[model samples]
Target: MDLRFRDPQTRIGNLADEPILVVCPRCSRRATVTPERLTCAGCALVRVRSAPNYSVWNGPVDPFFREPLWLRADCCGGHTLWAFHERHLDLLERFIAAKLRERGLGDDPGLTLVARLPAWITAAKHRDEVLRTIAKLRATLS
Candidate 1:
């Protein structure tokens, strides 16, 4: 069977709505995704692919439309974890932090969501979409 992957940039409908997070595991360097390229600060290595070299999505919908997809690539001395944000991690973190503060649960600084995160997030499968809906509802109510 022939397999093909879509160009990473092409799938993202709007750059404004989506921001990419790049993390290098080797040197523990992280940065926002750049439109032109991604250069690791710790090792000073750069991404050569014109389009983000992300792995193929196991689902039907394009990865850009799904929850943040973490793609790891060999970089520096080890690997770089690229988190393509459909909803942006910063916003999610803020939302969580705000809710935590409101409930007096204390802030979970540097909260990391790893495997099985999809199940815990609102609407499970559609995390970003559900989060957006919740935010909209909160705005409407407030």
Candidate 2:
């Protein structure tokens, strides 16, 4: 007896085992999420999907099968900004130093001094401003 039933509109609960793919509404990039909450990789915005078994499916899964978090490329900038959050200040400073070095401002005493500032100071400020400062510093060096 072939019990296989296929319905295009009908989503079978058994298929729920499959990872949900959440696409970013803004950028259309894929994101990872816990079973209950969907996170946009591009934006990092968290949303709850209207589905059961939300907890069981939450975690990193194969990108292909996972739902895409439709987000704009600009959204990913939050991740960069969040790096300086108080909780991750040390890591953020390291990242800033590395970026400064990449832009050839590593030797600038002023740039190095700014890089040593507490991550909390950076986090309290706007990331775009920081980026602009770096760019201006680079231009001065050149």
After superposition on all C-alphas, the RMSD of every candidate to the true structure, in Å, is 16.6, 21.5
lDDT (Cα, 0-100) at 122 in candidate 2:
52
Off by over 4 Å in 1: 1-19, 50-87, 93-119, 123-142
* Model 1 lDDT on a 0 to 1 scale: 0.36
* Highest-lDDT candidate: 2
| Model 2, span 43-89: residue lDDT tens | 77777756453333222232233442221122124332221112222
Q: Tell me how far candidate 2 lies from the true structure as C-alpha RMSD in angstroms.
A: 21.5
Residues 1-142 of candidate 1: C-alpha lDDT, one tens digit per residue? 1122212222223433444544543454543344444455678766544655463443312232232223332222232223244343333334333322222222431232321123344233444444454444334222
Window of ten residues with lowest summed lDDT in model 1: 1-10
Q: Relative to the unseen true structure, what is the C-alpha lDDT of residue 32 in candidate 1, on a scale of 0 to 100?
A: 39
Q: Model 2: residues >4 Å from true position, as ranges?
A: 1-11, 32-35, 49-142
